[model samples]
Target chain A: MVLEVRDINTSYGDVQILRDLSLKVEAGEVLCMLGRNGAGKTTALKAIMGLVRPRSGSISLDGVELTAMPAHKVPKQGIAYVPQGRRLFSELSVAENIEIGLMARGKGRDTRDRVLNLFPVLNERMKQRSGTLSGGEQQMLAMARALCLEPKVLLLDEPTEGLMPSMIAAIRDSVTELRAQGVAIILVEQRVDAVLPVADRVAFIENGRTRDTVDVETLHGDLSLVHKYVGVGH
Target chain B: MDFGPYLFLAVLEGTVTAAVLALTALGLSLVFGVMRIVNVAHGEFFMLGAVLAWWFSSMVSGSPAIGFLVAIVMAPLVVGAIAVLCERTVLKRINYDPEATIVATIGILYIIQQLALTFYGADARPVQAPVNFRVVFPWFGYSGYKLVVIAASAVLLLATWFVLTRTRFGLIMRATQFDSETAQAFAIPVDRVYAVVFAIGAMLAATAAVLIVPIQQAHYLMGGDPLLLSFIVVIIGGLGSIFGTVVAAIIIGISDGVISVFFTPTLAKILATLLVALVLVLRPQGLFGKTPR
Candidate 1:
């Protein structure tokens, strides 16, 4: 397995956010987690990324345990999280923004050149500050910055939450290309259509727990679980 | 009342005073800029610097030039070492609670003051200006060391400017000032940076004392006036804008020189305080400060 999260439970300020949410992904495979607005989607990602502390369960990437490390160290350990907000350093230029990812590795020009090539828009606006970028452009910048780290597993929380259909299509293409590079991805997304076509398998989450997991093709037809867990009658 | 000579004297005095104020304000501004700590005890650090410089000068066996160099060298290093100790031992425990830091630094201030009284006695220590440089160019016979002091201070200020604007160290320091978490995320080692920055600030204050001791007799309590003035300059300049501090310090320096010469020294202080109050009330964000994001 590339990454495994088992029986993970977490809370924030006395309010529980995750309960026994378990998911597994093989190397280079695309895994989609489906849920409504507050069904522990972001929390699970935060817990896995070490941004939020969990009260119970173990999270291991491949064979190495990764439950207690600080969020800043997580990227160095080969997991890069493009947080829900895509928190790029707003004051920094795009090139400087990407360079921050490789700061720990000591040199970034080569990685930067490569990431820029992946996202052509970033190449053209390398000197422009991150603040000036549009929503889609900012998302691309966040992803490009993380890619500079050359992370083994990329955890993206709602990468297409606020983007045009064209941009969403572009992101799908980018992820597909990333998969071809043998990079494993765990995509948390709201739109079924946006993620379902690309995902090999899907996990439907609700009320801070994993309600069901099935192949994406099977999940598309299994409208009964969707009605019960997602409150959507399909 | 011969206006021509008196006015030129005041201008020369103002130039000299501005240099001292510039150095003092830079240290205070640097601490507040990066740490977000007011460092209320900073003034006390200046007081300590003056006292140490005097003591070290007396200990050195040489001409007044060697004594002057000794003061300049020892004051900063001593004060900086003390600063590092305070940060590691006391401040590390407080975690930079503004109220807590303010209270804690105040405690340090009084403790240092009492110790200074015991160590150096209540009497003032005089630092002698070198004989060769003491050839005063008579500006209405008000003394020409003011002009020499002014020139020397200008060089230091320019050097500081060059280092800050031109160095990679300044880039990382400025980055930390802008956002602590982001800088640390990039592995800048924030804890070490904070200590180094604090040491640099203490060194600047120590340098200010070295400059001023020759002009004004060193006293244990002399730090109070500059400390108060730095607070006003800080308000006028806003936090972290070094350029703003320099501009504001010069304005205050001129106003202060004129007011002290024409009016009483006490009245001059009152007027400066009043002006600062007016500015603070009118624009709390300070003259060059950005609104909190």
Candidate 2:
């Protein structure tokens, strides 16, 4: 396994969020987290990224302890997070945003060029302010910024929210491409049908606990699992 | 005797005031923009700069010019270091919460002011201008050092702009300013960035204080006016915009100079205060500040 998160419990003040959540993803694997709203899926990602410290349990990447590391240092350790709502530096130019990501890893223009190739739409708007980009373009730029890290593990929080089917397909294709290159991905997605094409496994979370971890084929055979955990039919 | 010479003189004086005010207000703006904290003690940093300049210049026995040069370089560095200390010890400890920072900085303001009073005394001491010359206008003569102050301020402003817009560190600062959380996710050490930014802001204020100390005497309470004026400029310019801060400084500075020449200094301050009230009522975001989406 490339990344292992074991029995992590996290809370915001008195209100507990994630309780005993556990999952693992190997290199070249895509682990999709399925849950209803407020099921602690995003909190799980934040715990891994060290944005929100887990109250207990272990997070290890390649057998290196990460639970105690600060949030800023997590990116340097080859874990990149594209947060919910596509938190691009809205006032900054597209080029500057990419530069910030590249700067994190001390990567050069070569890495920038490669990342830009993944989202060619960004190249034309290099000098344009990111806030002016359309919703789809903003999502692409957010992904591009994270990709600049060339991270071993990529955590995407709802990458396809409010996008057209075409843009959704584009995102799935990028995930597929990253998986092909042996990058471990933890995708927090709401739609079961949208995740099946790229996800190798699905971990259902409910009220801060991992309800089940099943293979894509297993979930396919048991569509009711999605209805049970997500409270929606595919 | 006529309106021509009076107008020219007022404009000249206004330009000098604007130059110094821009540097001071830019410092305030940067701290607010990045850290989202209102530094009530910012003026104390200015006061400390002026007092330190006096101390440094007094230590040297050579040409007044040499002493002035030493004061200019040493004062800002010393003030910048103090600011870093403050950020790490007080501001960082408080987590830079807007309300807490305001109260903490107010406490810092009194501490620094009292320290200066105890050490530097209550006297308003003057430093000699590095260059003692006058620019003779057809209508009247003006201080050559004042012109130098204006030119030097321009260079510093340009340098600051270059650092904010062109350099990689500048990119990190802008990124942090826009969204510090995301900047952290990208591996930008935001706490360190806050420390550096606080230092830079203090350095800018100190530089302004050093430049003005030769023209205006260095007094323990001199920080009060600059601090108040900087708040007016920052508010009118919108909170975090460097360009707005500079532009607002010019407007307030020039208006204060011209109005004081025509009428009274007290009236000039009243007018500027009224202008701020107007800006706040109508364009709360500032002239150049983008409206929140």
Candidate 3:
């Protein structure tokens, strides 16, 4: 396994948001997490990134304990997270935004060229401030910013949530390309229909617990899992 | 009183006062821009600079002009180092609450002021201007030292502008101020940056203190006016408004200079405070502050 999470429980001050949430990802595999609104999907991702601390249980990437580290330290340990809302440094230029990501991984020119090649739209608007970019462009820029880190495991929170159909397809293709590069991915998506083609495995979570988790082909065959667990129209 | 020469003198006073206020406010603005804390102890740091310049000049046994420069350059560095220690050891922890941080810094201000009084007494120390320096442009009846102040302030401001716009470290500072967590996510080491910014702010304040010592006698209480004026400049100018302070300083300088000429210095002080208050009411962001995004 490339990443292992076991019985992780977390709370925000008083109220518990995550309860014994456990998920695993093998090398070169796509793991899609499906859930309704407020279903602890983003919380789970944040817990892995060390943005929120887990009160109990263990999370390890490449067998190194990651649950106790700070949010800034996560990327340095080979895990890059494209947080919910695509938190790009809006005031900075497109190039500067990308360069800031490199502060985490300063390997060389290959990182810059690789990120630009993946999100070619950003190459033209390198000097423009990131706040002016269209929503699709911002998402591309956000992902590209994370790509500069050369992360072994990419954690994406709702990558296509607010994007158009064309942008959605573009993101879908990018994930497939990344999958082929032996990079493990954990995608938290609201649209369950799209992930059947891209993900090798699927886990359905509701009310802070995982109920139905299955292989992608198996999940697609079982429409009742979509209706009962995913809460898609019955 | 000859009208032409007096008018020229007034213009020169406005220029000199603006330079003084603007340079001092630069460091205050820098600290606020990066750390979002109003360092009330800044004026005392300026006094330290003036004292250092005098000490250094007396040590050299040559031109007092050389001593002033030493004070401007070295005093800030010393203040900056002290600030680094002060920030890391003290201010970093209390930053979670804005009101608490301001109050804590006020306590620091008292401590610093008392230390000055203990070591250097309450009596005013007289330091002479350079031997070559005197009221020049006697044709216009204006002081040459005031013009020099204007020139020095302009050069410093320009240098600061260039560094902020054209450097990566500057970008990091901006990011840290605007959104510290994001800055750290980019691996900027936000703690180290904060310490450095405090140091830089101290340095700027010290330089202003040293430069003004020749015109006004240095006393333990000397920090209060600049401290209060700087606060007014920053507040009326808006927090973190670097360019706004420069423009407002000139406006305030001229207004105060004119008021003092017409009436008295006490009346002039009230008018200066009123000017800042009126600006705050009409345009809360001051002359140069951008609309918050």
Candidate 4:
């Protein structure tokens, strides 16, 4: 397992959000997590990123424990997260946004050119403030910013939410490209059908627990398992 | 006597006030900008710097130049260290909560003030100017040291602008300022950055104090005016806006200098307060501050 989350319990204040939640992902595989709003999908991703501290659990990447690490230190451990809503630094320019990832690791500008090649739009809008970008452009910039980290695993939360169909296809294509290069991906997506095509395995999370895990090959023939865990026709 | 020289003098004096005020208030704006906590004790840091400068200069039994130079370097470092300590011990413990940090900083202000009162004594001490020269104008002579203060402040402010806009460090500070949680997700240590910013903010005020100590006597209670003026400037310029703070400082400083010379100092202060009130009523975001999104 490239990433393994074992029996994690997390809470916000007195309210528990995740109870004994566990999941796993392998290198170069896409694990798409599907669930309704308020399901523990985002929470699980946050826990792995160490944004929310899990009270008791063991999160490891390639046998290295990451549960006790700080949120800022997680990316250095080879995991990058593209949070929901494209949280770009609005005041900063697009170049600065991408530069921040490289700056964090104290690396030079080698990866910047490569990432810019991946998203030429970001390069075109390099000097523009990120807030001025369109929603689709911002989403692309967010993914490009995370890719600057050159992580072994990428955690994307609703990468296609509120985007147009063409933008959604753009994101899906980017996911496929990254997957081909052997980066493990934990995609927390709401559009089940859109991600199903690229997903290697689909994990259905309901009420803070994993309901079922079905291979996309198995899911392609019949989505009965997905329907059972997700909804009547999801 | 010709009125032109007097007017020139007033402008010159105001220029000095604005220079120092810019340095002092930049600290306040920076602390407010990144931490979102109004450092109530900010003025105390200014007071502490002047006090330290006085102490360090007095301790050196040498040329006034050497002693003053040592004080200039030592004072800000000491104050910056104290600020870092304060952030780690007090503000960090409170999680930099907007409300809680205010009260915490107020407590810090009192503690620092009282400590100075006890050790530094109640007497206001003056440090001798390191350089003694006058820029002889056609009508009147101006102290060269004052010109040095003004020039130094301009350079420092420019340096600050350069750091904020041009450097990678500035990029990180801005990223952290924009969204600390997201910055952290990108592997930027937000807490460490906050501590450094707090120290730099305090250091700027301390640097201002060290520069001004020769002109004004160092007293435990002298922090009031700088604090008040800085707050006025920050509010008028817009909270956390560095360029705005500098611009506001000049306006307030020159007005304070001119009005105080022509009219009364009290009127100048009253007018500044009125300006702040007007800005607040008309444009609450401040002249240079971005509207909260």
Superposed on all Cα atoms, the candidates' RMSDs to the truth, in angstroms, are 3.7, 0.9, 2.9, 1.4
Candidates in order have lDDT scores of 0.80, 0.93, 0.80, 0.91
Q: How many clashes in candidate 2?
A: 0
The i-RMS of candidate 3 is 2.2
Cα lDDT of model 2 by residue, B1-293, tens digit: 79988998998898999999999999999999988899999999999999999999999998999999999999999999999999999999999999999999999999999999999999999988899999998877889999999999999999999999999999999999989888989999999999999999999999999999999999999999999999999999997899999999999999989998899989989999999999999999998787876
Clashing pairs in 2: none
lDDT (Cα, tens digit) per residue for candidate 1, span B9-117: 6766777788888888889998888888988788878888888878888888889878888888889899999999888888768987778999998998898888999
Against the true structure, candidate 3 reaches a TM-score of 0.90
- Candidate 3: docking tier: acceptable
Q: Kindly list the per-residue Cα lDDT of model 3 for residues B1-293, writing each as its tens digit.
A: 68777766676676677788888888888887778777888887887777666666666666677766666677778777877777877888875256777887788788878887897788787666653446646574455676677787889888888777678787777777777765655556777888888887888788777777778777777888888888888877776777788877887777677666667778878988887788788987776775666
Measured by DockQ, the strongest candidate is 2
Model 1 interface CAPRI class: acceptable
Candidate 4 i-RMS: 0.9
**Residue A146, candidate 4: C-alpha displacement in angstroms:** 0.6
Q: Tens digits of per-residue lDDT for model 4 on A29-72?
A: 99999888887899999999889999998899999899999899
Candidate 1: segments with Cα more than 4 A from true spot: A1-27, A30-74, A120-129, A186-194, A197-218, A221-234, B1-5, B130-138, B141-166
Q: After the best TM-score superposition of candidate 4, give how far the Cα of residue A187 lies from its true spot, in angstroms.
A: 0.4
DockQ of 1: 0.29
Residue A27 of model 1: what lDDT? 69
Deviation (Å) of B158 in candidate 2: 0.7
Question: Reference contacts recovered by each candidate, as fractions?
Answer: 0.12, 0.83, 0.21, 0.98
Q: What is the C-alpha DockQ of each candidate?
A: 0.29, 0.88, 0.43, 0.87
Question: lDDT tens digits, residues A88-195, model 2?
Answer: 999999999999989999999889999999999998999999999999999999999999999999999999999999999999999999999999999999889888
Per-residue alpha-carbon lDDT of model 3 for A70-138, expressed as tens digits? 666777888888878887778778987887787677756788998899889899999999989999999
